[model samples]
Target: MCPHFSTGWGNDAMTSTIVFDPLLPWWLIALLALVTACGIALALVRGLSGWPLRALAGAVILAALTGPVYQQEDRKPLTDIVLLLEDESASQRLAERGETTASAAETLAARIEARDNTELRRITVPDGTDNAGTEAMTALSEALAEEPRGRIAGAILLSDGRIHDMDRAPDMPAPLHLLHTGRSDDWDRRLRIDNAPAFAILGEEVSMTLTITDEGAAPEGVRDVPLDISIDGDEPQRFNVPLGREIELPLSLPHGGRNVLQFTTPYVDGELTDRNNTALVQINGVRDRLSVLLVSGEPHAGGRTWRNLLKSDSSVDLVHFTILRPPEKQDGVPVRELSLIAFPTRELFLEKIDDFDLIIFDRYKRRGILPSIYLENVRNYVEKGGAVLIAAGPDFASADSLYRTPIEPIVPARPTARVIEERYRPKVSELGQRHPVTAGLEQEFDGEWGRWMRQIEVEQTAGDMVMTGKDDRPLLVLDRVGEGRIALLASDHAWLWNRGYEGGGPQLELLRRLAHWMMKEPELEEEALWAEATGQRMRIIRRSLSGDIGDVTITSPSGETFERSLEEVSPGRFETQFGGPEIGLYRLENGDQSAVIGLGPAAPVEFEQTIASAAPLAPMLEQSGGGALALEDGMPRIRDVRPGRPAAGRGWIGLTPRGAFETASVTQTALLPAWAVLLLISALVVGGWLREGRR
Candidate 1:
């Protein structure tokens, strides 16, 4: 049984409290106090008994001037909120971390809910795209912003501890504890490309710095790890590298355009994942200088056109030679007066032929200038990875035509001893529209092309005819001999188009593409497959001379394949786009052609440090009077902790008691009523007066 005390008004009790409201000005109160003090002093000096009565009257007047009331509140208790941040980022999905995180979250939620006056705010942090890795802290800050700060007793984070948004972490009011998820024995070996140039000069050595590191509890005395490197999916070259040390590698790109260099390390047992074990770096190859050899049997109208085309390019190093006089023709002019320099046939055709990227035989004919042995060398050069372009003239139909030489085996066409001199419009053939070198040339010229006045009749023996003139004769023929490429233009009147004859054409563009195609430029390859990435989307492209290209198969970073049919955007170009579901390497294949491209960083920041540890969030936890506990050991018990105390222990984590509440209603009552106060003051005055009278 309980006893209660209350005023004798009714069964209901009223609690009395005191509050104040001054009714008089400070100056008036001060004046009253001064007068009372003076009267008291005078009475004491005069030995008068009535001074006490005067003081009592002054006290009653002051008491009536000040208003007093009592205030009461009806408050409802609020539960303490504990923020739980569950990380579902990519790094957290490694090994058995996902399971561990799920388990820990469930246990924590149950424990928090079982406690009295406690609530759990579970917020899930996911992975970020555009190379932005785990942003767990950002999610935590957002959750904190949505809830009342006073009600937030504490925060518990379960993650792999790889957070990218540490700078965005909020200044928490309560303890922030990190329950790191991962095993102690979880280890990983990764290949790191420290420094690489985005563009490297072709045929020149470019230095790349790389480091191989072992994280977590790697085996002791581990050294000389085998590192494999490959360029453009070629066979990998293996090398021994010391672990955890940076090494410099000098590489030379084989050709121009994008070069994919893949660096990988052999997987070791007990490693976390092989995702970071291999890395990809794309370095574009650029030509420092293109060396071109131009051999002209005699000066002609198109000879200067070729010179101008090669000369206009700043990257080309042109070496031009014209055979003015043959050995049979010995004019009576003096040697010094004839010319200052003689053509070095041995240097251009035999000795240093491989030094040039392209060799053009413009209207070349056999006039006893180059020996049979030297011509044989040119043939051997073409068969062994060399490029030759032939611009034919009337001489191509003559007995001295190059078709009569040993190099004719590689020529795509044979000249029929007939030269037609009739105005005829040059048109791209059906195959030309499907060949990368001349695919869109007709469209670029608006389907209108200039006419050539002369064309040497030729019979196509092999190769593809991309352009035709004079009754559908082979005007331009392309062929591949062994590892080399050969292109032949049977007419020299192409220069007429350069002079804007009949509204001109894409003469410059045509010649540029032709030259680059013979040099095996990746962009001009007839059969090629490649991909480009923008954000999380990838544009896959396929180029083929064949009509039936079929579908393209895409393999994701996780080894999942998706097939998509190609859409023909142009003659030879087939393309489609894929919205990447995840970031990493993507492999694209169409029939026999295959290409590998990476959508994000070679080694994403999420997997950069795969061995999970609490070092990243340690500072934040320490600042909030909390500690890090691993889930591998076991789930910790949730406990209530006081403010400014340690919030984590060996087997338990703590949440602060907020003692928060909400006021439902309030009541205000006067401490003393007007009549009651008046009576008390009157009694005090009367008693003082009676005492004075007695005195």
Candidate 2:
């Protein structure tokens, strides 16, 4: 017997296929089955001959009623996709890696494009912003998601193997190969600050832990390395430390507020970069406790004001003394009956003088109670880094004023034995508007302040006259004596502001700033240059008492210098913002003052390991049966392979063959015509009847 199958026929060409579509409903087919079954049953019951032949004839008639069709389609084949990812991050730009990556990428792309039925996808990964390091894996994941999964044959990467987002790696359908860059002998030395306190008590030692480590192919037998340390742009101190070890150093803050401490390791030959070899840590210094000595010559209305102000501050430890009676005015009462205790002048003035941070003399006059010897000690104390504030009154103009005592040498002004008693408003001098202590005081009172009742007449001697009253005489004077500071307020009526006489002024604030400035707070320094950094931007601030502030010179970590002129933001403050191009230490200089600050991390993550290696991406390559090849050896050959097979070898990379395609058009046709089916049914009936007749 011979069997036949039909092919489809379309408008363009002739073809063959086999399909079926029933012409009659299911009830008619069921009725035909019942009639055929009855006839076959009758023939079987009568033992009739040719029973199967009759049934065959009936089946042929039923088949011609049902219709069948054949379908055909036209398909267009799609090319396979190959991804080439190139890394151009900061780490990849080091040494010869940039050249290596460029060359390798060009060659690999050319080779992939030369192959048959292959499409090349080129993606370049750049350095992430805000110090995010390398993000090669993120780029790869995005490329994979955009392309057809079935058509993606393989992926190739050219990088330094410093990927930061390995956890975001995709579940790749094809092999992922890496071509490493950079030399194997590359090495680097870095300084790491393991632990540093953001704040420390001033004049007290704070501990910091640091480690110096050598990475990559470092020289053998290397142990001790010279390290240099500096504070606030001062001279650097050199010390020898063992390599690859943690060391603890105790640091002392010089004054309050941001104190910059710089640590550096000497550069050696064959290192990647010296950027990580230096580090800067800024510590905010806070005073543990401020001790102030308040001495009142005789009790007066304004004496209690000084006590209240000093006692209000939680950080101040106040020691106050009042002389109720002068030695010349001794009473008849016995010494034992006296309620007052000895002032202990010798102990406070000579022995423990250095313990106090500030001393205030309110309405004081040279009396016999404190001898001239003890008064000389006060003058010596001021010259040796002590602070003294003299609140003068009518007594300052008298013959026994402190100007006649042993402390006369350090007095900023001399009284002329004339006291002006009149209502006059205090005013900030033009120079005072530039001085830090009095710079912004007028702004607080809208350029107007309360009145003072009296001011001592004095000569314009030595020191800066920050305030004036009554014929423009110096009302407030500030001067530096040796290493100490002295401020003399000629009037004792500042207490009037505390009493809110005629719309009170910023007397409290003024007095507070004056006290702090006298104690040498860094924020109140007359001549200063400093820079504050946020991210990669820095704000350079210059504070000066002089009206003429020269241009500030900035030095970058790589020894590049830039000069920028400061704009006067206020009376004495000049400031400007700079966007630093790179991360590392920066130096600022204005006249004789200088400052140093660090930007970004001490050791950026990109420079932590400079040498190129396959360790970071080794797991991904192993899981996908891919291999890593060093570009320094040579560019590998590209080849095509079958899926589920090894995609890489010693000197070659492979891409899988994806047989992807698309259908452009389709067509359908009936398998047989109506006349042909009728003819076939007639032939079958005649043949079956002939055989039955012969029997």
Candidate 3:
């Protein structure tokens, strides 16, 4: 089928003449013999002595030099082939290169199969993990080694120009050709969050920096983006967030809790994809420790409630002062006979007020035990980041209540005179459900909650009514005044709740949470955003008052921006997870909130995906004058490409014909046998002797 082919004579039909002349080849044998005879004749004409010996030596030298041999048979020359190496790396999988490579491989394979003299060999390359590039050249070297170098003609390569293993290229038997794939106009954009901290102190100002970038196909002059930030699910604050710059935002945590900061940029309406929009971070909030002064007005059934809750945790140091007797209303017995210890008001509240984090007034009245100046000092304590709790009995609505004292300026509400005794089950309000202290309580209740025996109705004008008593009056209220916090549990029946006298509630846990919250524990605060990352994926959570969270903005390490939304599964918890393409610290902002989370290991996925092809073999195929075609492409037709001709064409490369000596049958003739030499010597000697005698 190949046009370059020629029919060769059969072995039996082809017979060439053999010559046994070492001085010349068969073509020059006649001339060499003539030259030798001329030499011998010239010696005789010159009348030279030993002319026969001279002629004999000349003839022997000529025979050895000619190296004459007899030809046996000749064989047909084999066709040379060229192989094409194709690239199969991860980068090749991008765009339509994979499809192109596959098509080329098939086309070349068919062409090789159709040609009688050509064969197709497929060498597929797998991508090495961890960003190692394609090994196409290595594959070509291997293919070259397996086949005979003399038979190879040329090679072709099908690839994207991303070959990584160039160091081990082999000596090519043919020329190499490259066919590259890819379009020039590809582009992309990504959201990036540059740096965020993992821990920040509660109630302290912490700064976070954010950045955004455009990748691949960025439009020119995109600027002045608006970004929203939120902390612990507060109201979103918008800023004229500049593009291509790191913005420093100063943030202060309001309470001690797990502070989840979510940062986000608005999703660009017309973008390729929203996958890279928002970022999230979760930081734990902690206070140095809360020191409380427990002032016992008089020992009562509920007195232990305050002590038990505060003392249960080792972090809180309680300075308990019990007033056994008043200076005016003392019993006739001596002070030493009294069971209770004398109140240390001057030592606890007066001298050491600064050392206390919070002070509890348990049913204390204007008993004239302390001066009004001391009460004023307590109010100053509340103004300077201090906390206070009031456990009121019926005396709270009376004329002797602390509201009548100097501390009332910092008091949120004045207790009304009305007090109602009624049984009620403790329940969390809508706000309380989201508050960190109450969110997970549903699991503990198991549908049956504990009941309180009695609650006092109080009229509240300010603060949140977290718990209700009979007729829905606020039984427990929390309020902020100045720089301090105050809470009031109006009834003393909380101890009954813990005792389970009315079918126990989460009294211990609730009381514990309330006390800690009052003390400003970070996890007990409401409204937060946080994230945890495992490798390239991240799990983001937003805890907020609003059950539904808007889209979150994420910034990646490469300065790309993306937006994501939070789905609320519980009352106040909103959450989602995303796969991060790169490994770095990412910043997430939801509205005015922001957090930082990590993505990917410092080292990413171990192996990169390699496209399956063998383009690196192209050079070897070309050098061998063989066409390296993809098996996926049509296999090239192998024809006799002339040995000294260009390697590529419709057919295979030519194989060179060997010299005649390659097929010649070799024979060796010794100068003479030992017996012939001895006889020659004897004849010479006998002739010499006879001649001498005649002389």
Top TM-score prediction, candidate number: 1
* TM-score per model over all chains: 0.85, 0.83, 0.49
lDDT of 3 by residue, 645-689 (tens): 665553232333211112233233444434654566556545544
TM-score of 3: 0.49
lDDT of model 3, residue 549? 70
Best by lDDT: 1
Better of 1 and 2 by TM-score: 1
Question: Which candidate, 1 or 3, would have the higher TM-score against the true structure?
Answer: 1
lDDT of 3 at 573: 80
How big is the positional error of residue 621 in model 2, measured in Å on the Cα after superposition? 3.3
lDDT of 1 by residue, 1-695 (tens): 12323242332234334556768886787788788788779878988777766677777677666666576555567889999999998888888999889988998888888888888899998888667898888898889889999999999999888889999989999999888997888888888887788999988999988999888888889878999998877789998989989899999998788888889898877888777888888989987888999988778888898899899999999998777765455767553344567657777787898998888999999877777888888888888988999999999899999879989899999999999999999888999999998888877777578788999999999999999998999999999999999999998888999998888888999989998898888899999999888877889999998889999999887789999899989888999989877766677888999997877777788888888778889889889988888888988887888999999999998889998877656577776678887888788778867877898
What are the runs in model 3 whose C-alpha is more than 4 Å off? Answer: 1-290, 328-347, 350-354, 440-443, 447-453, 547-549, 602-695
Give the better candidate number (2 or 3) by TM-score: 2
Candidate 2 wrongly placed segments (more than 4 Å): 1-74, 142-150, 333-342, 445-448, 622-625, 659-695
- Measured on C-alpha atoms, candidate 1 has an lDDT of 0.85
